[model samples]
Target: MPKNKVYIFDTTLRDGEQVPGCKLNTKEKIEIALALEELGVDIIEAGFPISSPGDFKSVSEIGAVIKNAVICGLSRAVQKDIEVAAEALKTAKRSRIHTGIGTSDFHIKSKFNSTREDILQRATQCVKWARNFTDDVEFYAEDAGRTDNEYLARVVEAVIAAGATTVNIPDTTGYCLPHQYGEKIAYLINNVPNIDKAVISCHCHNDLGLATANSIAGAMNGARQIECTINGLGERAGNTSLEEVVMVINQHHSLGFYTDIKTQQLNPLSRLVSDTMRMPVQPNKAIVGANAFSHSSGIHQDGFLKDAQTYEIINPEQVGADGSKIVLTARSGRSALAHRFQKLGFQFNRNDIDVLYEQFLKVADRKKEVEDEDLKVLANQYQTATV
Candidate 1:
């Protein structure tokens, strides 16, 4: 891949399914795995093989069938976990074993009850062990957001020297501000002696609603790959939203960064993940939301009617949306009213609109929203009354 090309590491099946009650069967996992592959994701984190038998089977089956994308299985910094990840990725045309340990002091002392030295040893050892299976090994410094930058750089250098081809810096708790996260990535890029030996990847969470921002900052600083879940689905608030990040890069051409994702497939893929997982995408959610292309406010609708570019920055078709929407509501202005009426085969001149305004306001006051059916009835009644 070119230096400017960002690789999309999709962890939808692994992290996305962590949403409570959003589990998928092996067949369902395969369905999504295949879709992700067709969507041109560079890597797919199938699942954590050591977490459950079903997950192991799903990862293994996904590895067996996916043709282009690298199939990855997550594991802890333990021999058995790495072994299971390797076993699960055996059939992949391209495979990766993603293994790592928590690096933040909070997780090191409270969660692992281990010293910094011990964790460092585990991080390198896991990479070395994973190398026995394949040359594609990614070491994640879980919770690196809060980890001391100097210590984080040390850990990154050690893992790269120990044969890890990709080093992941994850904001596990989503606590870092955008500048702070970007600075951390910059520190690693400038400080790590062997940094160029491995690809720097960002895996940001959304607890504080900054995952997408933090991920972008990471890329701007040095990280070349982004680990994201579809629709921002993951534990707690969720991971970085794939569609948001991709579109942000696309819309901001001056950023000079690009990804391999097919922009048009974003909406279809978002809906697929939502439907299969039974997770609802908020109607106003960015990118793939149902109302992303809809306009109802009077000013916004009037601007959109004259020219979509007035109120809309992105062309709806750019992300596969059918078209822009001018929804009729009490807040709608004459332009929107005229636009929708014209769509339904009605034409009204300036005097006619002024004449209809009184009746339209009456219906608008009576109902919460004036639908096309109601407007048609109003138009017919006006013709009768005038006749």
Candidate 2:
């Protein structure tokens, strides 16, 4: 088989905005949509048109303005929703109306109080109605992580036959393990007869803190598109982080799958989304974290001083983050101390470095973090003692 290309479908404006208090107005959504295109995202899920007048307007305006990316709108498995979504996306240079219904037994019993036959019938009708507006229709099986594999395969086949160009298997509640999610995609691949007609997409949440892991598993199992949001911002736990998924594929190109994301833009893109959404990414979060490249430990600092690859897998520059900081701390070694002193315009001999390092360690033990002033003061004291 030829190498598969993974399409990045960004849902930051749709599912991401669904997070309470993270709602963005039309201007904010447009700003994010443009950034997504510049970041090389293939499709941007602009908004859910039928949910509110504001949402419908934003989706329409975004469709009108964004020319490079495939602008999309989300809708439920209802005729009205599909009509509204299609209308919103009609002006897009490239458009897709995503329509679907929940297929899990829990959703049928607790949410809709409907039977399996009724659910499948509704799902099939939505796809067909969406196809009436445009050829680019994507059908999602909401909460597919818990839906029976056999029935899910049936829905996949029905939607494809109904003219869906893409099929999304979403772990709506983030309930499945990585291996289980992979098996679900594989099951559809093996059982669905018309699966080849549509692209397989993965939409996993972060309720279990495994959204990125599950996405990789789905891709490894044959998914061609990965739906994500910046900083994993979404309802409840969150969605997969766009930077995490893109960097994973870049780092492991041996898998024979690649994304269109420009890796160097990951950091700036992350900051842009964070500022627009008013969502602060944690310092320890992977990829775009503040401390991802900073080193303070003696052993790690020594290795990093010799070669960054010894302590880091991905280079900070590769993701647009500033290079590693050889922090001066209680655990910092002699080389780190010397490096800091040299930057401060002081060159120390081997003996002077040893003395200054001992003093720096004691000062670091007192302060949580050492400042440049502290280093300079220590250097002055060392010079005075020698005189």
Candidate 3:
């Protein structure tokens, strides 16, 4: 409805901390809030204030100090929770009260033992209550992926009317496929009457290993904000990774959606979060992973040497990572060996390289990885003795 600017809503301190063994104290929360601001997030969902005293203190402190990004505190569809959230965010320059409840049949029956009508009423009342404190209120319909589209549309419309500035559609179970999630978002975009009044957001989990894909699909269909975490660390499998989503949008600006995220700061910020939270980023993750830019395949190494675009969609430098790495392995080619050898100051002609290539191959075949020491020994043997 508005300009195609995709808002990057980072929740690394809130839902991410909810993950078992990923708890963070107040100081750590503030540290991450500052880092998230520096990373250029539009909104930082700091924490659920009413969950605990420590959580409330962290939200309040972060709101007081963080001025660049919108500070948000989460609350359930209850009066006390909204009150706590409001109090916690009072010092924020720009504050949003994130309030909502589950709407799916399973959640309504099994989790809350409430009817659909009751859940809708509770959701609308909480949104209205949140609006009394701040004009910026975000309403989340938990488990929205499986919720009936007609009822979901009704809830979304009611929340918009009740003064919600943003509505979050959470794939709480991470059970929906990309196509199904995209259709769900599209259904809301087309069916909801007041959908344009508020921004549609996505909070996806990685249980099905499709969180990033589902988030991208939501944006393509019409969602404007993506709620994600650093290093893809969150509850269960994790949420969509902020770095992956930011890099994707940055590289493909023609998609008609872009964020304010600083691409070059992604890797450093990811490492900072991972280290502070003790959530090790998997080596093979898409954007900021240790091996995302490393090349080990012979064909891939050759293509990368000729042109980085042949293998990489975005330059590694853009995400604060080094250029393509030529890891010497049994699968490596002569181009890779020659490139690495030149880096070590070896000046070899085509004939000399051809002679050493065979030797290097033999050594590589015997070893799992070719080390610099092995290359040095090989280089020394091929040249005439001067000493």
| Most lDDT-accurate candidate | 1
> What TM-scores do the predictions have?
0.98, 0.98, 0.96
> Can you write out model 3's per-residue Cα lDDT over 1-387, one digit (the tens) per residue?
334889999999998897788899999999989988988999999999999999999999999999889999999999999999999999999999999999999999999999999998998999989989999999999999899989999999999999998999999989989999999999999999889899999999999999999999999999999999998888889999899888778877678777988888888988888888887888899888889999988899999999888998888888898767888998988789889889999988778888898998899899988999999999999886433
- lDDT by residue for model 2 (1-387), tens: 576799999999998998877889999888888888988999999999999999999999998889799999999999999999988887899999999999999999899999999998998899999999999999999999999999999889998998999999999999999999999999999999988899999999999999999999999998999999988988899999899999899988788888888888888888988888878889888889888888999898888889888999998889988777787778888988888888999989999998888898889999978889999999999999999
Candidate 3: give the clashing pairs.
none
RMSD of candidate 2 to true structure, Å: 1.2
CA displacement after TM-score superposition, residue 87 of candidate 3 (Å): 1.1
Q: In terms of TM-score, how similar is model 3 to the real structure?
A: 0.96
Please say which candidate is ahead in lDDT: 1 or 3: 1
The lDDT of each candidate is 0.92, 0.91, 0.91
The window of 10 residues in a row where model 1 has the poorest summed lDDT is 1-10
- Candidate 3 global CA lDDT score: 0.91
